[model samples]
Target: MIPTNRQITPETPLDSLTLDELDQLLSEKLVTLQVDLLKTYEQQLREHEETLDHLHRHRRAISLPPRPTIGQDDWHSYVYDTRPSREIASVTDLVTINFTNVHTVVDIFPVALDNIHAIYKLDSGNGYILQDDTMHLLTVRNQWTKSPTGCSCPGQASDTRCACCALGSVLCQVSASGVSNTCVEDSQINSHTCSSQSPRSLELDNAIAFEYHTYSEGVQQVVVIAKGENIHFYRLDKWGLQDFHSLKGHNTINLDSPVTHLGYGEMFVEQFGTVTRKRYLFTFGLDSSSKRYYEIVTNPQDFSIETGLSMMWDTTGTSMKVWQNGGRVIIGVQDGTNLNIHELTSDRWGRQQISLQQVLSLPAGVTSWRSYATGFENFLIATTLPLPALYLTVATIDRFLQTQRNIPRNKLQLVGVTAMFIASKYEEMYCPEIGDFAYITDKAYSKAEIRKMEVTMLNELGFNVSYPLPFHFLRRNSKAGSVDASQHTLAKYLMELCLPEYSMCHYKSSIIAASALCLSLKLLDGNNWSDTLTYYSRYTEEQLLPVMCKMASVVVKSSSAKQQAVRQKYKASKLMKISEIPQLKSKLINTLAEKSASYA
Candidate 1:
């Protein structure tokens, strides 16, 4: 409803007031009430202005790259000189290991080179590797519980996770040496073993490629044979021994497509049809560079792989893929030139296709780095990781928002919260609710205080929530036909790859901004050369391109000096040279474009 600029008298009743009259009264009351709101917002604006001013004032002195990466010393000191066996310790081994399927925990393993004996997928969303050295399952949870067999032989026993609490099942390990799939049940101390119908098959060279399966709420058990290119399902349930399904084999020597192996959990396996019999089967393929998703309609009577929908990604020069979020499916359709998102709804045959027009609705820009993680409240969150420098900038802005007046607390919280969400994308599967943030805040902030801050922040920032800056560069730089012929090449490259929505700048300026931002962050905080390059390497460098990486470092340092000079010489004019900022943004875009065009 539109508000009126009229005054109201005290005689107006609460319900008797007309819509117009109510609006007028509400407007008047708002003016009166907002005296505090205005002041708060104004204070916040001033703080934001001051921070910008301070940053400008000290811009020359500010360092480009942060020094001393986190955990540098600890990382270097923890040397792995000996090769540890990757075999899972037997049930008789006296040790316990924490197990989980969480992705964040994947990077926390102290021993990377050590062989993983068994990979355990828990009902809880986390994956863990069985280790022989410590004999303890390590997880991101930071704690481990001893299995019944290993309870007495624990090396570190701060806390033990009760076996009963576990889902009470382990992935059947099949090796050439032939090991039994028996493990102690959570409720029962005795071991329950599943026999191997075929004496251990070492058909596959890579153990990591092997997958585990079990169905029937444990009534029917099925072990998936992931050896070779084709998948073969073996029924391990009381159905005795029988080959439930065997995929048409493909000889690796006659490779046809870039075959990628994707993982599925219990829920996905359940969706494969029903507990009683097999339900659905499908495979995904890519056309040179574009991603195509295909689903096969399976008939339990006679298993068949049906040819489902085939889709061609709209944009050129992109690395595209699909990911499932909780119940919903998310398709990552990178144009290689621009970023696009499409929601897929399947037909009766499971044929799914997305329209080009609908692709326009997503958050614009070529994504630099994106990941889905499970949030605290089981909500799924897609996040973008920030460079260290950008994080510092955000920190500075947050500080300003907190202390400034005229800004609502919610406003400031919005910025920090959104950034937090973006950063979490590369790590977690989900993002927590806004209320979750509020709940956590109680440990440090009061509700009223937060509300006040939010209001002030919204007012100060002019309520701008769009941060398509990264995408802008991606689109321009990543376009399929883009060429690196001008200063704007980098920007074009960014637009091509990132597909960032346009804001107020040219494609070139956008490229400069994104590249500078990323470069600055890496300089300030990245540990190794590879970590520093990250997305930038897609366009600017090759696999482990040390020389290109070094060039990026030089580019950032040179640009920092140039920007500093501009700040000093022009002082008032913020004009700066384009060369100072690294051109990774452009390079990435052009690279994707070339890649796309090649396929086209």
Candidate 2:
């Protein structure tokens, strides 16, 4: 039932109702705020003679943007009334409805406010009133929008994301409506009885700062309440509040002093999706004498101090206000008058421990960089050897790279050069002199080092260099299918297309050859994966489809992909200029690629 003012009172048992019931009442019912909740604090302020002057000064500082219209509602009529900027603040994106009268609005939720002392603006469309004895939580109804503080770009196709998208800047416009989807709304409801707490401190006495941290282990949410020398953490579970203080550690984490301001972690990493994953807590400590900046680091399990310009260093800041992410801080001697307002800025975030992208970074590094080794190695080794020897060099270099560990980067060149020297001796009528391979890499290595690395590569690969090449399988499949000159070269080109890609490095020679033929046929608009071709390849149409799709996606991305060496190599006329084929970019090829891409 829709509740009326007569049905509920200041003494109503709101805690007894379920959260869904509270939502229905607040959203659909008429709300009467008859109690003079803010009267005690602001009753005499409006009568003060200087109030208008202060209001006008405040009005001049705010540069309001043009009104926003979302959904089908006529913004002026439904959300805003025609009023001068000074008389009515733009709060439709923040809180409130058109007031029926001075004392009543259409909707509001209640908290037991025994003696409301102050009301403060909470981030993300949430409201709370402060009282000396009891905390009042006002959950507003708001919708989370994916509608970005959006790109600062011209919104053109060719425009790169501006610095705000890559690295956030003060110039970034963070509307009260949203800040990178950090939850700000015109009206949002997000309170759950999901949090129940009994901390070392029974009440939030002398509480100063508050932050809601995003928790990832499910739909859980954690709220941190900062008090003198202590931080009380409250969290919500999927099942709602269940033993919020249930963790083994103490309910409140004690710190050295009262935290003036706290921020969620910010790592200025360039990689996408890694911005607060490191989760370093930034705490700003401001005093009249000396300013302090601390980063709560996990690796060292200790705090690091940062030095910055003095902030109100002579007179104690009555309160400190730090902006979102990182930037200048505003400190005032008194919270109200903005007295002795000074800006404190940190030139740099304090030193932080960077996590190794897991311990496998070195092995992954060796795999990616070894291609450079082969490029240099092949110039000397592949020059005089037969075409078969080129494949041998690639396969041996792949072997040395895949099995070996702890090889230095420059040393990898020695390994690659030596592998080619081996492939040359095995495939060529006479191997090139060991000294020739050494000279090709700008004489970076001596003939003696090449000899030594040759022995080591042989030993590490277990004296077994009998790896097959994709060309071997390609020749067999082409012979069976009677592929013509252009089709054969096109199939060869597709195999080479993936040569520089480490992501597909693990596919066997037979598999690579099969997928290449399949894609080449489709690109030429020919009958793909004929019976003879599939029998020779031992890979049916079904088996080769995933890999062919992968090849098509790679071709589509090659124009913009960071690794373009293979594409560039095949751009030559001798290689059929296959990478430059306009059909390689046809919509039909791309449509074929849009299927399930998670093929093993």
Off by over 4 Å in 1: 1-244, 247-255, 261-290, 298-328, 333-339, 347-351, 356-600
TM-score of 2: 0.36
Q: lDDT of each structure? A: 0.33, 0.46
Worst 10 residues of 1 by lDDT: 76-85
In order of listing, the candidates' clash counts read: 106, 10
- Model 2: lDDT equals 0.46
Error of 1 at 411 (Å): 46
Global fold similarity of model 1 (TM-score): 0.27
Candidate 2, 1-600: lDDT as tens digits = 433434655577988666766786675442222223223323443343245445656975898765433211111110101111112223136442332212311112221122332333222223344343433443221112212234444444343332122112122223332222222222322322111111112223222222223333222333344444555544322211112222233344555555544333333321221213223333434432223333332222111112222222333323332222121123322221112333333222333332111111010011000000111111000122344666788789887888776788868778777877898788655455665565344346766688788888899988997878888998999889888777888888777667666767788889988888877877786676898887778999899877787777777777898655556555645557777888888886788667627664
TM-scores for candidates 1 onward, in order: 0.27, 0.36
List, residue by residue over 164-187, the lDDT tens digit for candidate 1: 112443423233332322333334
